[model samples]
Target: MSDIDTYKQQGFGNSTGFGARPALLIVDLQVAFTDPQHLGGGNILAALNNTKSLLAVARQCGIPVAHSRNVFDSVDASVWCVKVKSLKDLTETAPASQIVEQVAPVPGECIVRKTKPSAFFETPLADWLHQKNVDTVIVAGCTTSGCVRASVVDCISHNFRTVVARDGVGDRALGPHEASLFDMAQKYADVLSCAEIAAHLRGALPG
Candidate 1:
């Protein structure tokens, strides 16, 4: 049997499916990550475009939208910055810490500033989602193998249905991106294309 089939037989990959209420969670699509000159940058333009498309659909459907940024203040720069030196440049006042203009958060959207890989870490994301009655989270973001994966796992752990848009989340290299998507699909979240998720959201909305 193929690996996927074996995983299915082992009860590893099971669909939590989309829930009645869903929110779009865009994770770390900041200027530092989108611009190749800065740390965490690579060919993420395609992923950004896909995320923008998803954002448009979410807005039309009136789905609650939230964004996460990896922001570190001077005193709060923790050990994470030591391991990833580039993170030092992502201070709260830095321009690179801002969300990319292409997929900027609009009014009424929640922007969660985190100092770690998972958006929920020491952040009010869970509380915010609960306040909005968000039972499911549709995620899109950068560095699929890193922050994206970390956040998805946390979302599932928090008992929210998690969906990761394959095209909307990317990594610096294709190999890691593909691997992370497959891993998340088999273990954490439902991995689907941006178009597929958008279509589902469109249909799920009120008439």
Candidate 2:
């Protein structure tokens, strides 16, 4: 038996069905993380491209949408910053702080900012989702081993049904990205392909 088979036998893998009202949470797809010349590169390009199609469906379906960016007002002395000094340059006005154009937020979409990995940490994301009556969150983003994983755990913790797009999240390394997705699927969220999730949302919502 494979590791996945072992996990399934151990009762670690079970489906967490999605809820009626689903929202899209695009976490940290900013230039800093997406562009090849920036701190993160190469590996996440496919993920971002996949998200473009999913984002269009979400918008058309009127599913609540929110985008998270790693824009920080200050980063000095923070444990995260100490580990990755490149993050300090991701200030409000920095080019790297800007969301990539391919999946940029349209008017009325919530914009979440955070200095840490989880977007929900001291941020208005949870309250906003609550106000929208969102019972499920569909996630797409970069650095799957970092912000994506962190946010997914918190999304479930907030009593919301969590779903992650399988190809819509990426990392700088393939090993960590795949590992994080597997762990999340077993523990925190349902892992589905972006295409499937988008189709479900469209079918779930009325015309």
Candidate 3:
């Protein structure tokens, strides 16, 4: 049996269909994670491009949107600084920590500044989404095996239905990218394509 067949037999890979309200979280699509020159490479560029249309749909749908950035601070540096020394340079004022122009946040969208993998970790993301009464979150961003995955786990842990944009997230390697997608789909969130998600956003789903 194939891996998916085994997972199916084990009762995994079930869908957690979309809910009434949804929010869009573009996680860590910063310059540091998009441009191959600075800690970025692989298919991240394509992921960014895919997310642009999703983001546009979210804005047009009047969905609550938030963007995350890895903002490092010397005084408040987390354990990650030692593990990934490059994170040290992504200081509060560093351009690398800034969101890429291709997917920059506009006014009224929450800016979630994080230092670790999960956007909701020690961040106000949960509260913000709660206030918006958001029941679902559509995730789109880079380093699929990293921040995006972490955020998806945390998002479901927070009791929100989570949907991952397959084409909207990328990693430094295809292996981890595909692995993360499968793992997440089997255990944590609904891993759907950007087109399907855009359809849901356009009023085509359980909402």
Candidate 4:
């Protein structure tokens, strides 16, 4: 069997059933990755557009929206030094590390900054979602094979119903992106397009 098939055979993923109390979590879509010349850059424009659609629907349905961005301390080399090989010029206040303007978090949204891939790692996001009674988490963002995938797995491990926006998440490499999405769908999340997710949200909310 192929790697994805092997993963599924081993029960790495689960079904994509959504819950009544759902929230949205957008992963790292920072300027560094959006810009083609940056260390974190990729072809994620399509994912960004789909994520925008998901954002509009979440707002219309009164669902809580959360976002995560990677920020390292200026003087702290322990943050991402071990993970990222090319770690030069990646400071907390660096313009490249900021979320891209097109996908910027709005005023009322809760934005979480982390020094790691998993959104819940040393973050208040889990408690925040639990307090809000969120049973389902609609996920979006950049680099499907990295932060996005890690967040999905963490969400599942935390026992949250997870829905992955297929078009709303992108990768630096097409092969890895597709493989990650398939693996996530088979194991961690229910993978769907932005429109399907919006429709599902619309159906759950009252007029």
**68-97: candidate 3 lDDT, tens digit per residue:** 999888776878888998988888889888
Ten-residue stretch with the least lDDT total in model 4:
83-92
Error of 2 at 50 (Å): 0.7
lDDT of 1 by residue, 63-181 (tens): 89999999888887889999998898888889999999999989999999999999988899999999999999999998899899999999999999999999999888888898888
lDDT of each: 0.91, 0.90, 0.91, 0.84
Q: Model 4, 135: alpha-carbon shift in Å? A: 0.6
| lDDT (10s digit) by residue, model 2, range 70-128 | 87675423788889888888889999899999999999999998888998987999999
Residue 136, candidate 4: how far off, in angstroms?
Answer: 0.6
lDDT, candidate 4, equals 0.84
Report the Cα lDDT for residue 118, model 3: 95
Q: In terms of lDDT, which candidate is stronger, 1 or 4?
A: 1
Worst 10 residues of 1 by lDDT: 36-45
True-structure Cα RMSD, model 3: 1.7
Model 4 stretches astray by more than 4 angstroms: 1-14, 40-42, 83-88
